[model samples]
Target chain A: MGAVLLATILAIFTTMILALWRAIAGPSVYDTIVGVNVFGTKTVLLIALITYFSGNDDLIDVALVYALINFLAVIAVLKLIRQRDLAAAPEGGDD
Target chain B: MTELILDVVSGLLLLGGAAFAVIGGIGVMRFPDIFTRLHAGGITDTLAPLLIVGGLVLQSGFTLLTFKLLLILLFLLFTTPAASHATARAALVAGLQPVTRDSTDQKETRSSNS
Candidate 1:
């Protein structure tokens, strides 16, 4: 079971690296945002798995916090990117 | 016997989830445009977390930790799509067009112009 968990962790780490690459090299602003979002999701999963692996159940709270923050961060960044100023009003209907 | 079965099942789920994450990563890397990349990212954002966290829950077996993990899982379930929608909408608003079959030739010019 430990071996399985370790392997899973390693695999997720690899995926996280891949996501980081996309985040860094992505051509468009949206691509970068998508990469960051994916990375955050993986980070939460990684944290959860590590909590089990290290036998520190308390770290589960960190994973929960990560999930909430990641969602808000993505939304906030999108709003910022679209609005240019976070305090600005919507210029049109589509935006 | 039951413990062994549980262990095996959980292991499979964990591995499967990891595999999905890796595939989604590759898709994000190799996909042509932001819209397609979002499709790949969506896979990771949803299914990978579901499988990985669900497997963890199975291993924990009715503990407080399991409840917390479930909360994270449920939070992810509710938020990922909302994030994706906002992203796509933002991209559209930013003038990034989707790549369709007919737009294959136009993609390059459009991206270059953008």
Candidate 2:
């Protein structure tokens, strides 16, 4: 509703767009992981702003839950990627 | 008078947070390697939230809303860095190496089709 809040949200949207670039255009899988992580962080912030703008304090609880879930998502992705890489690696090598 | 001061202070903080977040985003696109991009992104995870949430907390004053804002900040402070560290370490464990400065061999580029 306020000018500042609206601008903040717009800036956040642009930030997400930049992160989307990384997610879609990656030389390595790690880039996508980083992109997704950054995007999640922005989403949390956006939710926080929305909560304040709407005067609905209840949404703060939602933001908190999202932050926790985002952390779990990153950890899970990293763990899975590491495991996949190890599995794909050859156990025996040529001398 | 106090309301005016509060409005000004919160406005400044919100603007600062937005500026930092967008800068970090641009850096994420510009940086050459995954590690460097993470460094850029870490700013958004930490500083932007600190400022933005702090601004919101100030706007809410001492109330249940402020408490919720504090909770959000606490969670952000504790988890964001942890996620970044875990992701970076996992990348290393998975045999992903940063591009060496001196060699200038591989050029990390976006997917052409995308």
Best prediction by lDDT: 1
lDDT for model 2, please: 0.84
lDDT of each: 0.88, 0.84
**lDDT tens digits, residue span B1-114, model 1:** 999998889999999999999999999998888888889998898889888988888898988998898889899999999999999988887788787656445544325324
Off by over 4 Å in 1: A90-95, B102-110
The fnat of each candidate, in order, is 0.88, 0.79
Q: State which candidate has the highest DockQ.
A: 1
Global Cα lDDT for candidate 1: 0.88
**How do the residues B1-114 of candidate 2 rate in per-residue lDDT, one tens digit apiece?**
999999999999999999999999999999978888899989888999999998887788899878877887898889888888887876676677764564665655432221
Q: Per-prediction RMSD in angstroms?
A: 2.4, 5.2
Pairs that collide, model 2:
none
| TM-scores, chain B, all models | 0.90, 0.86
User: What TM-score goes with each of the models?
Assistant: 0.93, 0.87
